[model samples]
Target: MSSVVDSTCEIREAQLALQRDGEELEHVEFTINSLYAEIEVIPKGNCLLQEKRHAVQSRIFTNSARISPVRSLPTEILQRIFKVCLPDDRYVTPDIRSVPLLLCQICRRWREVAEASSELWSSIAVYDLSDKGSYTAMVTRWLVASHHRPLAVSLSCRDAIIFHEFPLAPVLRWWSHTQHFITFVYTATISGLLD
Candidate 1:
């Protein structure tokens, strides 16, 4: 009779354990289903979040630029600052890599300030006018930017042929017509001519 009772108790324990395992399995399946549902909605939600973030970033950038100290500077002060940036060589060439031209390329406001500041354009050096048309146009533009200020010009040539071909008549005519005081310097280095 004791053996029969022991067998009955063991059978009852096994049934209870099987019921608990079934309940645990159902809970795990429900959790997996919930996760799948969330994954389906995540992409659209993520896109909306990204768009909001971008808008906020753009507003911050615009507001920061608007309140910048550089933008607050007066035109006269800015022009003075620009003058200090000019090269010490006294005569500037129209190279985009250099000060005056580089300043103009920065922004519209700087371009306006640099172009309007006659002092920055007062002295220019023209090197080897092999590109005659472009050089003339550039020289003309530089002179115009000088406005009524006194001008200093330097012309340098390495080859005699190119020097002779340089279109100087138009430049001379323009200078004669201007009321501003002008100083012109010409330098030529031919292999044998100087010796």
Candidate 2:
């Protein structure tokens, strides 16, 4: 009789696990649908927007895998995986700690996946220096981003909403580093963006 009771409890646990998995599948389906839907919104004569989407999709996959063709992975990733790696910049680097923390916190497996993906950690996204100065703290993050691999930077503007802060040295270095890694630089100036 005790054995029969144990079997029933096991069956109930199995059902609960199955239900949770079904919910997870539903969430994944929604994400994919949204990505494709974004493509549908692409209008005519906007080749640049289309190209950006394609490139982003490609990066999403490449970074997730963690293995990059570079002689080394990016510095932001290194800073994340190897905490004591760069002692010089540790004191003032807000972006360095936050980028990986946010991505890894998305979920347990994603944290594991992001951790494994050195490429995902490679490139750093710089926030511009704003008039309000929310991004003053992110200087180290930019440095962390360009640390291991040559920098692939995106510069927003001289505007208040300076979305990125690319290191000048790495920019020059990456230009001479490799032809295979194409860096993209984007800008949305404050006057144009806010006005």
The best candidate by lDDT is 1
Candidate 1, residue 12: Cα displacement in angstroms equals 33
The C-alpha RMSD of each candidate to the native structure, in angstroms, is 6.5, 26.0
The weakest ten consecutive residues by lDDT in model 1 span 170-179
Q: What lDDT score belongs to each candidate, Candidate 1 first?
A: 0.81, 0.53
The lowest-lDDT stretch of 10 consecutive residues in candidate 2 is 84-93
The lDDT of model 1 is 0.81
- Taking all chains together, each candidate's TM-score versus the true structure is 0.60, 0.27
What does candidate 2 score in Cα RMSD to the true structure?
26.0
Q: What's the lDDT for candidate 2? A: 0.53
Model 2, span 1-195: residue lDDT tens: 999999999999999999999999999999999988887766643787889889999999767755644325564554355443333431222343555545555545545545554454445444344423545434443344334554445544555433334444554463443333336565555564555
Model 1 clashing-pair count: 0
Off by over 4 Å in 1: 1-63, 132-138, 167-171, 174-181, 192-195
Checking candidate 1 for backbone clashes, the offending pairs are: none
